[model samples]
Target: MEAAIAVLVAQFKAFAGADGSTDTLSKGEFQNLVTSQLPNLVKNSADPAVIEQLMSSLDQNDDGELTFLEFWQLVGRLANQHGGFSR
Candidate 1:
């Protein structure tokens, strides 16, 4: 569990820092992260419009960027869906 969380943090940091911002992921960063790292988990990753809609849905603050928390929402949802967690 600890290792999994660490990997998640590291992955986020790796992408978040690509554009010199470790605090949030810009649209392009998010798209890259999803397409490269979550190819099997995220559907329609090849579609820019789908990625745009996903980013919009997860950008809770409407800041046009995704903070760690916002990004975590995607992680949590995917985990739930993959793990078949009831709730």
Candidate 2:
């Protein structure tokens, strides 16, 4: 469990805010992370429209970026669905 959390955090930091901020994920970063890291969970992740729509839905504050909380929530949902963690 601890390892999982660490890995997530590391990956988040690795992909967050290419312009320098380590606290949030820009749309491009989010798209890259999803398509590259979560290929099985996110089908057609390379599709810009799909990523944009998904990002729009996840951007709760409509800030055009995702904080770790938002990104974590999306991962949790996808994990439940794709990784069968819900079961």
Candidate 3:
């Protein structure tokens, strides 16, 4: 469990800087993160429209970028679906 958390943090940090900021993910960064790291979980992730909609849905603050907390929403949702978060 600790390792999984570390991986998630590492991945977020890895892609959060693609556009400039080290604290958040730009739209392109989020898209890259999802498509590359979450291919099986995020269907049609390569599509711009799909990425736009996902960004809209997850960017709760309307800040145009996703902070770690915003990014975690997707992770938590997926984990819940697979029973990884309900133990």
Q: Ten consecutive residues with minimal summed lDDT in candidate 3?
A: 78-87
Per-prediction TM-score: 0.94, 0.91, 0.89
Q: Per-residue lDDT of 1-87 in model 3, one digit per residue for the tens?
A: 999999999889989977667799999899999999988888899999999999999899999999999999989887796776666
In candidate 2, which residue pairs clash? none
Instruction: Give the Cα lDDT of each candidate.
Output: 0.94, 0.91, 0.90
The whole-model C-alpha lDDT of candidate 3 against the native structure comes to: 0.90
For residues 15-86, write the lDDT of model 1, one tens digit per residue.
999999898999999999999999999999979998999999999989999999999999998999889894
Candidate 2 shows a clash count of 0
Q: Residue by residue across 1-87, what tens digits does model 2's lDDT show?
A: 999999999999999957699899999999999999999888899999999999998999999999999898887898788766687
Error of 1 at 13 (Å): 0.6
Off by over 4 Å in 1: none
Q: Pick the candidate with the highest lDDT.
A: 1
Please count the clashing residue pairs in each candidate, in the order shown. 0, 0, 0
Error of 2 at 69 (Å): 0.3
Off by over 4 Å in 2: 83-87
Candidate 3 lDDT at 12 equals 97
